[model samples]
Target: MANPVELTILIEKIKAKTAVVGVIGLGYVGLPLAVEFCKAGFRCIGFDIDEKKVNLLKEGKSYIKHIDEARIKTSLPLFTPTSDFSRLTEADCIIICVPTPLGRHHEPDLSYVLNTTRTIAQYISKGKLVVLESTTYPGTTDEEMKPILEAGGSGGLRAGEDFYLAFSPEREDPNNKDFSTSTIPKVVGGLTPQCLLAAQTLYDYIVVRTIPVSSTKVAEATKLLENIYRAVNIALVNELKVLFDKMGIDIWEVIEAAKTKPFGYQPFYPGPGLGGHCIPIDPFYLEWKAREYEVSTKFINLAGEVNTSMPQYVIQKTIDALSENGKSIKGAKVLILGMSYKKDLDDTRESPSLKLFDILQKKGAVVDYNDPYLPEMPKTRKYSFKKTSVALTAENLSSYDCVLISTDHSAYDPVFIASNSRLVVDTRNLIKDSHKYKGKIIKA
Candidate 1:
């Protein structure tokens, strides 16, 4: 068990802003968090297994689009980025912000989280506070992480006694200008009361507000519930989109009207499909975990099925648009607008745009993409397109048989695209509903 004196000393360090904050896996979640701690007058150390990321950060460069390089350069004196794990002993607070992606069969792959915990246990000392910011299924922090960390450490150090442990899921919305890391309300849950207090005290200094829950399991479930709610709601709208289209009803106009009611409704817009790191993947983690307890997640599975079918639905729309002008899908020139999953961001993880590109290529269409954020197509596990981004100009747009609007990047001129393209299959409803481009627009 940890000595009470040791716990008190750690709390004093945190309150005084004298604690060294160590953040592991400095990607989307960790980089912003390290910056927030540094901005709050704490000396921060960032750890990542990627040598390229470490080297870049060492030179005071920012790789993420939303994070400013000036912030990283100015905070260099207080922040140190490295790949070494031996420095783990120096930090008073250590937070794990690694990725917990789904595997081939959509199972929760905890390799990154477990490997990082094992490494931390080797050098973790008594009275140190550890918090997990990675999203996963319930019981992960208590059941999986607690066991690995305890077995790897020595000196009979136990969680909540010899050391403190907590779970605080990351709620990072990339490219969102309104709410930042410091502005977003944080949720924290711990193994014990002391553990909760230690974790909450550390975050109170960084975020605007911190909400403490009952246990780590609740914290884990909280994140899953948030994403699952979005997934099911988005799936509901996506299914309605197809049905409304067949009934000769415009879903966008319907949404605009329904939102005016101002009661018993929260509007969620339909897209080509669900994108981003959270909505498309997080729900499946709960679905996979629920199976272990002999339970079924029918809503999650159905949402997955509905959202996954949107790419093909879009392809059929493209084919229909081409056929209207006496053009066949085979050997047709198609230009995909935007490649990133969301608007104004460079992240393309699990993007529906890539799936659309793959299906278009396999169906014998000549496909090209243009995104101001992404100048070149990145290589993924299933795709290795060496194609570079095409320029979005009147002359370039006129050459394609159909222009497909996948991602509604703000930089794209929807009016200009609709005017120049032979036909516009608007998946995002970017084109204005006016008579100028009446015949040219086809909403997917």
Candidate 2:
């Protein structure tokens, strides 16, 4: 097959580092990827609907924690952050990195993806490459987006010919010192062979490597599989955590000992619950898609059930810890440590801590939280705490009836927390040397 003129032009521009790249949704995934593209010598136009984020980036400031302002300042010459959608025509390549959250019923919510596509279609022209980096169910690029773009204002322009289309799932691990957007291997899939090549060539300039798959669905499924693998493993450990608690065995210690064998075992830690954008939600995308094919994803559904049940388990542990301390959960003064999903990062999407907070408040416990990373609770899709982090002082720590350690951020001093608190519920296994603080600690 002859390469489309769009593909040939895009490839030439990409190699020459002159391609004007446009990235939509400048959040965790988009911001880092756009910065990498700028560092790779491409002039990138970063698009976001949030005026505050756009304005901050325009002034070389970063809203995301791990992405330093110095990096944004350095990329300012080549990176332009804006809320303008009409400027889409100025770019030779566009990448969509919007959030693919689940709806109320756990169905795949592609409003962000589809709305961005519709905006791109308005300004889309010939000889441009379009790629979707949002994590979604298989066939989204081909089935949902392609038709929208084809029937868009471009006068029924053909995909893979008029404009290249592809799916390259984002692999963003925030606060992981080991990996960044540029270091991670990107998986690219396209609607056609030319679409694949164009997308792969573009990512090759910024990323370490590009793994090209047969089709867009394969690429989408590849991402789901990566997260689902983690989801299932974590669910296994979560289920074991409940059982091991009854058996008087420490799941963390068991994992540490089991991981010594190295060959047959990989360790997945149990937390309060699943947090972050990918693992907690990505599996459901596949599960929801499986329903259309009249297939039952029993294992995946079971994993979801186990993972979702973890927050309640954490609550039960809290209740038990309080009861042991000669108090009831009702009217007990409780303080939650760490508001963000994971330790040391401010990204709180799907964080189980929110669920825990709502449950505790509903259960009539006086709840407050402290996270060094998050000062005030921001409004989320399903939660609105309207509270700021209390100072982690010795007096403040001693005041709470029960102190629950949800995120084991490195900033937290285990000894200090144990010495001050009346009772503690340790979820992340944050405290070590249990003999010294035996009376205060309860591992959830």
Candidate 3:
């Protein structure tokens, strides 16, 4: 058992010296966290079960493009990746940033979290701090997680004495240029004051603000609230998008006009649908938990439904645009502009672009995608077309009757792409030649 004085000195040591920080699951959130710790002058161990990722780190190669190559090449000595759980003994603080994807029924599937906890539990020891950065239910850490870790040890965790536990939801916006992982404020909560103190101290080293919560549930709930807010607002605009599409009015114009209000309105744009990690997945965690309490989350559930219908709507629009050109979707060569979830990101998890592909294929359109980052869309429920063709050139693009721009990738050479293509269906408002289809460009 550690006294308050001892823990205080320990925290001071963490802030002063190069503490060994272990970041498990080297995906988007974990990779950035490891780099942030290394940049903060802490030695970091980026642990992942995937041997390929571990081997890449060993060779100083980075798979994710958003992460700087210089960081991997130059920062190799401070950064390391390992699959061995025994190496976790060297860590002063450990953070779990693995995926918490939804199940088939859209329920919060905690298999990743539970399996990660099981692995971490095997290496359980005294004095090391643990924090869950995965977005999931509020009671995950204190309720489900605690018992699992306790089962691995000889003695049980006495809240703050034997081991420390906390939940600090990662607000990792993958492609956002403005806010970095260090600049974004973090919300942290622990099982007890000591756990909170230790977790807050560690995050404060790399992040701009450490907003301490009273309990782990608050920290967990805070993440869901942020995502749910986005989901609801996006659904509202998506609702308007469909409405305006039917009324022959542009939703983008209405949004621009509304943004003139200084205080009342904050802008949220409607897209093909919700994409990326948090907004599409995190709200479902809250919804799943609400069910355990025998409650219904009507607004949130309905928002997900509305946002999900967007891809079909886009597909219908594409068919209409092509038909207007005296072309049919069946056996028509259709080119999709982007495959990644959003603009500038390589991450395709829960991307609406994939759904659009499925819908297009279902309508008998010969679907092929062109993305600079992702050469092809991987195998999914409907499409197995993950092969990159020639770069988006006029000759290749001109052959297709219509080009549906799903993601606004930064690499798009817009002027050239527009010139070669017969008709462009811009779902993301990428091409601002907003004059709808001079028989050339259609804004879906």
Q: Which candidate number maximizes TM-score?
A: 2
10 residues in a row with least lDDT, candidate 1: 431-440
Error of 1 at 122 (Å): 1.5
Q: Write the per-residue lDDT of candidate 3 for residues 1-444, one digit (tens) a residue.
A: 546665776587688855688999999999988988888888889899999989988888888878876777676779889998789878878899989988888888899899988888888776778899999988999998998887765566554777789999999888678998999999999988999999999999899999998999999999999999999999999999889988998888899899999998999998898888799888889988999899999999999999888898888888898889899999988899888887887778788888887888888988888988886556653347656744777788998878899998878967777878898888887787656436588777
Clashes of each: 1, 0, 0
Between candidates 1 and 3, the one scoring higher on TM-score is 1
Predicted candidate 2 versus true structure: per-residue lDDT over 374-419, tens digit per residue: 9999999999889999999999999999999999999999999999
Candidate number with the higher TM-score (2 or 3): 2
RMSD, every candidate, angstroms: 1.3, 1.0, 1.9
- Root-mean-square deviation of Cα positions for candidate 3 versus the true structure, in angstroms: 1.9
Residue-wise C-alpha lDDT for candidate 1, range 1-444, written one tens digit per residue: 456887899899999999999999999999999999999999999999999999999898998988999999988999999999899988999999998887888888899999999999998778899999999999999999888778766756799988899999999998788999999999999999989989999999999999999999999999999999988988888999999999988899999999999699999888888777788889889998898999998879999999888998999988987998899999999999988899999988888899999999999999999999888998875578898999999999999999999999999887789889989998888886634776779888
| TM-scores, one per candidate | 0.97, 0.98, 0.95
Cα lDDT for residue 413, candidate 1: 87
Cα deviation in Å at residue 106, candidate 1? 1.1
Which runs in model 1 stand beyond 4 Å of their true positions?
A: none
